[model samples]
Target: MTTAATDLRADAEATLQRLAGSGAQLREDQWRAVEALVAHGRRALVVQRTGWGKSAVYFVATALLRARGKGPTVIVSPLLALMRNQIEAAERAGIRAVTVNSANTDDWQAVYGEVRAGEVDVLLVSPERLNNPEFRDQVLPELSRTAGLLVVDEAHCISDWGHDFRPDYRRLRTLISELPEGVPVLATTATANDRVTTDVADQLGVSGQGDGALVVRGELDRESLHLNVLSLARGADRFAWLAQHLDELPGSGIVYTLTVSAADELAAFLRERGHAVTAYTGKTDPADRERAEDDLLANRVKALVATSALGMGFDKPDLGFVVHLGAPQSPVAYYQQIGRAGRGVERAEVLLLPGPEDKDIWAYFASLAFPGEPQVRVALSVLGDAGRPLSTAALEPRVELSRGRLEMMLKVLDTDGAVKRVKGGWEATGEPWEYDGKRYLGLAKARRAEQQAMLDYITTDGCRMEFLRRQLDDPGAAPCGRCDNCTGKHYDPSVGEDVRVQAQEVLDRPGVPLAPRKQWPSGMDALEVPLKGKIKPEEAAEEGRAIGRLTDVGWGPRLRPLMRSDDLAPDAIVDAAVEVLKGWGWTERPTGIVWLPSRTRPALVESFAQRIAAIGRLPLLGALADDAPPRYSDPEDDSEPEPPNSAQRLAEVYGRLSVPVDLDPSSGPVLLVDDVSDSGWTLTVAAMLLRRAGAPAVLPLTVATTN
Candidate 1:
């Protein structure tokens, strides 16, 4: 099995040259992985640094294997961005690569036909699609049997957090266990500690003992990465710093945020300050995300304000810098993100501006881990009693879990064989499942430890790169002589006084449009709510405004602790609400004011509305009073984000509010006030009641909204 000495070697070399240009050559480790997969048909794991030709190995091996009449290679890629890059590279190598992902749903049939007709050499599929009802029940069985080589990019994801966040990845274990003998399998990752490496290798090995796989690991260090950290006490300060110094850093890059709201907020600030930037977060539309990636790649945008959703999407070796608005929870995760930078450039600046609210964000994500045994039991029982399969949407109301947690649980359960994802949805397998309390405990502990390590990395006086490397358990972890500490060249954290003021002003600028909900929550029939599908256009509230999102940098932090405070909203809060109303730019000024009775924060809502009515000198219409509707309880964990099904919520809110008898609607649009708008259902119901009372229009104004 001397692959390098064989005639097939030329094909592999040519493939590399095609993808990486005429001078491209495979390094010894690349050939070793290629030899294992293509020549000897054995399993292997390659742990190399980013930009170390990991993709090169697989594409070259893919071309070589196809030359010998092997079936198409199926790569289980993790992100849409990663899939796009791989497909582009494969095309350059003349390897017909196609992807099956959520974004390309319309082309799935064509892609499948191509794969079956041997027109495709490489097929990339997202981990989430691994257990898609149709894909899992129909496509996977055949793909599993005929795949020539199996490649798991970002193989580190097979570990704990991956299982929790992307539970469908665990299904690969079953896929690997059932592969026909002698079929080559390769797993690759740039970020994996010893534990992760061993765990992934064990999973990759058919024997399940991990000894059957060849493990190749290289030193994890990037010379082009110049690491530095700047502590910013306030979210506004972070934005101010970026606004002031972003152009001074390097070429085009990314500015990372912990939350979607932060990304949206920061990008708006940067763009207002005359920077070409855009926000890329989990909430961004798939088509828009792709456009943002293209803009960043083309250098049309100076930076992309993004969250972790942009991770692993870059194949660009020339990305100049990466700046974090807040630290990620794990040092390895941080290292992986920063690795996206300095990949192709001689020097790319990597900066971390750790915010005070980082831990809160960390705890929020950590809380989404595997649900408690009781919740799992509820889900299982719901599926068990159902005579037919149930889709995630149909099951969400009964499971009492957020969409994220519910989908995650279903995937984990599917992987465990406790439930099966059939064509329509999931069905209970009647497989007795034991809740692994011990494993969950260990995961929790490991998460805390990793978080501590991340904090240490922030406070460390030692080399930043060395600290990250050591956290990943690299033997060669030592001072890189290039970091801020090692080079004695720290980034100046100072922001110009004027720029700082501008940033604060931007944050303080209130008035976010509260677009009225045109559609009632779907599946309301299950909750016995009369509302279904689209709301009547005439009954809908007119587009309105909120002071700001609760996630806003300036108002959000101030409003967060105030969500529970029933005391009168302070003068400053009242003043901000007035500002949003004053600047609303509405087509028709609200003729009168009406307030919603709050279950919590009654004083705040009334006081804020009273101030607005007094300031505007409008008639003070009475509240849309409620009569003890069943209220949803917050999760004991506090981080399990508010339950998300609007139908169930509508059920609790429907018919609960009544319009004031004395209110006259023919005058004009009336202002409807609330302390906060979350789900927008409460406001929707209120507006409907107001409209029913003959109001020409209802304009909703809230101090804050969760969206």
Candidate 2:
């Protein structure tokens, strides 16, 4: 070998020792990737399994490149947990790494100073940072010019074809274009099918030229992962099994849920059953999330019941197991999450406790994908006519989309150069953008196919590991001797009857407190709404109750079907509603009950109100009359209208709800009933009318709440 080649090998060996241990060495493929980046200065994409030491390649390369007086490496990471792990791992290799993310806003200036002084060897940034106005305008250009290496972690997100396509990661194309020639770029992910791989490689290529990335892909299989799927009839049954068998799992690990509500609910149930577990979700406070992660890492907690917020980048080498309470929408996403387990252990158990409601959850998330052409046109028209950048909040009322969906659309549009996000918000760029109907339809088809594949995964009597590897198009797809189907089922499928009864009791216990809206949304008058500021205490409804949240695993399945059905609520729901009223602990019993006008399910709402009044022995006051025309005038508009914010909703309902003209003014207090409470504005306005019509107080009750 040449002297330089021999020296490079020796240096790489020393760095590997520092990264892994004294006896650690890079495998042939890993060395090839490191050499491609450090010696050949070629862009590379590494599609390896979770525990294959993808981080080591970049860290070692960073060390070698920095030694040659090249600028510091910048890693665009997807999650804070991953960033934390990478920073620590980099430190162990004698590399100084600093992170700038939303959590460490106060430290950004200091981190920038360190980066400028050449005191930092590596800098980790969240992908969202790439679009920040200040960072993009001021810092990004310099980083693009000076960065010795650019690493995109969780790189599959860069491709729209990937299961977790993040629009912010698409901004990397602009950054990549700005980079000087010969600067090595590395994109690494554990999950990417052949299509996603090709798409990502094309995106990583220089200006759509010939293949620019040196692809290093290995078999996407974890030998330590013992995969299994347990089909349960109901969500409660799944919880029962978890309660029965949680302790028998290998070690401390994660219990994944498809929704934030499920994570919190499952964690609460497990804790009630005497398990040492904590809930981790998107709503978890950053500090608390850090503590929870630490606790799990230190084996202080038995498991962290979490949503996908805890997925992607969390690294725990010896994590003992991973359990899913519900199936994720796509097998690719499922593979990414389960990959978290069995990373550093001989055999980490991975189980999927699939529920009947899994498909419903999947469908709900799928509905949030890119908007239709009509919706996109509406957004652009609103922005273009305004002539000023409008924040998402301001734009929400004018557009017929939810705030989350609206923002996501805006980000995608911004990446496509149709809209530009500025200091205030987003403005139209006047660029004529064509709606890619074919591409979107293809994506929708792909998603459905993925959902079906997950269903097949549940029922397939074939090797579970082989099924997942095949989903990723892994060339080495074969039956692993470890999965449940390959070997006999290692986990008990049945829960004790006593445990099932307890789980049913916990889930069936209903009544979620409905907090009253305290303040109105800002800028109501500009929309020609006659409301502003905090809601008057006398006009507001008292804290209320709903039978359950539509997202709750317990009542969700039961209540959701009622949403579209014209049939009266079943006997069980009526009994639950009565239970809610009995346990309400009100200071004064309501003298009368009134119902809100329901445009969609009038029959269901009226029946529920009559039943409640008859059972409670309260005076049955008539339903509140809607004096105004239907909320939307266009009869042909089949699209579901986005409910206006608090102020707009209040304005629309202000003069519309009329109390019974013959009702006695001395009716003490009244119970206001609605089929569902979605912005809580309908109940709010109705309560204000009741209070003004001489009731001393108004108490709102609904069968379900849309949170």
Best by TM-score: 2
lDDT tens digits, residues 409-512, model 2? Answer: 99999999999989999999999999998999999999999999999999999999999999999999999989989998667678999888989998999898
Candidate achieving the largest lDDT: 2
**Error in Å for residue 70 of model 2:** 1.0
lDDT of 1 at 386: 90
Q: Which lDDT tens digits does candidate 1 get at residues 1-707?
A: 45555666667787899999999888989987887788788888898899999999899999888888999999999898999999999999999999998887899999999999989999999988887778877898888888899998888887774322367678899788777888898888888888788777776663335445678889999999999998888877888989988888788998888888889888988888999999999889999999999999999999999989999858678899999988999998898899899788899999999877778678767877888888899889989999998888788767666777788888888888899988878899998899999989988998999999989988999999999899888999899999999988988778888888988888888888888898875456666667777899878988878888766666777777777467887888788887887777888888898998876678988888888889999888777767765556322224335454555666677856777667666688999988887778888888888888888888999888878
Off by over 4 Å in 2: 206-212, 632-660, 663-666
What C-alpha lDDT, on a 0 to 100 scale, does residue 491 get in candidate 1?
81
The TM-score values for the models, in the order shown, are 0.93, 0.96
lDDT of residue 261 for candidate 1: 80
TM-score of 1: 0.93
* CA-lDDT, candidates in order: 0.83, 0.87
